[model samples]
Target: MADWLSPAEWDALRLSLRVSFWATLVSLPFGLLVAHALARWRFPGHGLLNGLVHLPLVLPPVVTGYLLLLTFGRRGWVGQWLDQWFGIVFAFRWTGAVLAAAIMAFPLMVRAIRLSVEAVDPRLEQAAGTLGASGPWVWATVTLPLILPGVIAGAVLAFAKAMGEFGATITFVSNIPGQTQTLPSAIYSFLQVPGGEAPAARLVVISVVVAMSALVASEWLARRAMRRVQGR
Candidate 1:
């Protein structure tokens, strides 16, 4: 199977995996935090924060990419400051692709975790607190364990989304081969050229396989988490 794919195609596949992994890894913690806040805390601007979290699901990917470019591009305000102070840049780089993928996938991850968090019994947490467990201990031992399944599911969802992300990625990074070109971008590139259908079709198959595997893994993880909670 590896022999059948051209080096360029292989690069795209590997790059996609790399980008998706980083996106999921970086976003998981933040996603859990946001989901926990939304599910457990009632604060000012809660609705606004929730809306912002899910905005990408409703907004066009192109628009999100454009906004990221404006905020994080080399000459953009934040981008300029970042470049001047920290020498970090997001425009047209694989790191930029990771950022785009993370943003696009964030809502799905948050939603999954949020639902799972909401399903957990608050009474269990309260009991733990009454037993002299501190806030952090109750959260770490009781709350976190119950919601592990959701977190795993959310991470998987985010990973799958990052793997398939195209519009925001392309818009922000311009699809530079071996740099910012991910699986979806590679597939788009392949389809744009004459006699490119074969490669495109192969990529499509690869995408499907990856997506299905992630879904299956997510289910398995979720079930395992549930079993652990039940056993405890």
Candidate 2:
């Protein structure tokens, strides 16, 4: 393992983990909200909103990156305001890499959660409401419990996607070592250099292992949650 993974590879692995963890954590609540809305709501522009939420899945990563750059780059409207008002910057930074990854992975997360939410029996939610539970209480005690498995699956899917993200991250955040350089970016950089193929191969192995582990853990969590919901 030591021979396979050099110091740079190790750094890339750690950075990738950090980025994916943050991306998944930060996106979870938003994914849940969107999923709930799509699953239950019937308002004007609902179709439009649903389409927009899933557009990332259909769009090219490079196009998504370019759009993010246009909306959140240093000179762009939102980025400029964030820099000036909050002293926060995303362009070409590790945080920006996280944002890009989150955006790219969001559709997958939303789709999974939405499907789960839709699968939940609305009759149970109505029954909870009739039993004197408020809207928030019904959602908290009834809807959410039924969809726990989906939430876990979605979070893991987003995490894995973020771990392997490349085009959007690189286009939005550039490849700065020890900064925005993730595992995939590191691998790409290694492949571009002479005498770097072996290290790149090692990183690839690490990436695959990490991804597989995440998926297995997600499956386990999903099954556990499903069993609990069934017991309920």
Top candidate when judged by lDDT against the true structure: 1
Ten contiguous residues minimizing lDDT sum, candidate 1: 223-232
TM-score of each model, in listed order: 0.97, 0.96
What TM-score does candidate 2 reach?
0.96
Per-residue alpha-carbon lDDT of candidate 2 for residues 27-94, written as tens digits (9 for 90 to 100): 99999999988988898989998999888788898998899898899998999999999999999888
lDDT, model 2: 0.92
lDDT of 1 by residue, 1-232 (tens): 6799999999999999999999999999899899999998999999999999999999999999999999999999999999999999999999999999999999999999999999999999999999999999998999999899999999998999999999999999998899998999999999999999999999999999999999999999999988998885
For each candidate in the order shown, give its overall lDDT on alpha carbons.
0.95, 0.92
Deviation (Å) of 62 in candidate 2: 0.9
Q: After superposition, how far is residue 60 of candidate 2 from its true place, in Å?
A: 1.4
Candidate number with greatest TM-score? 1
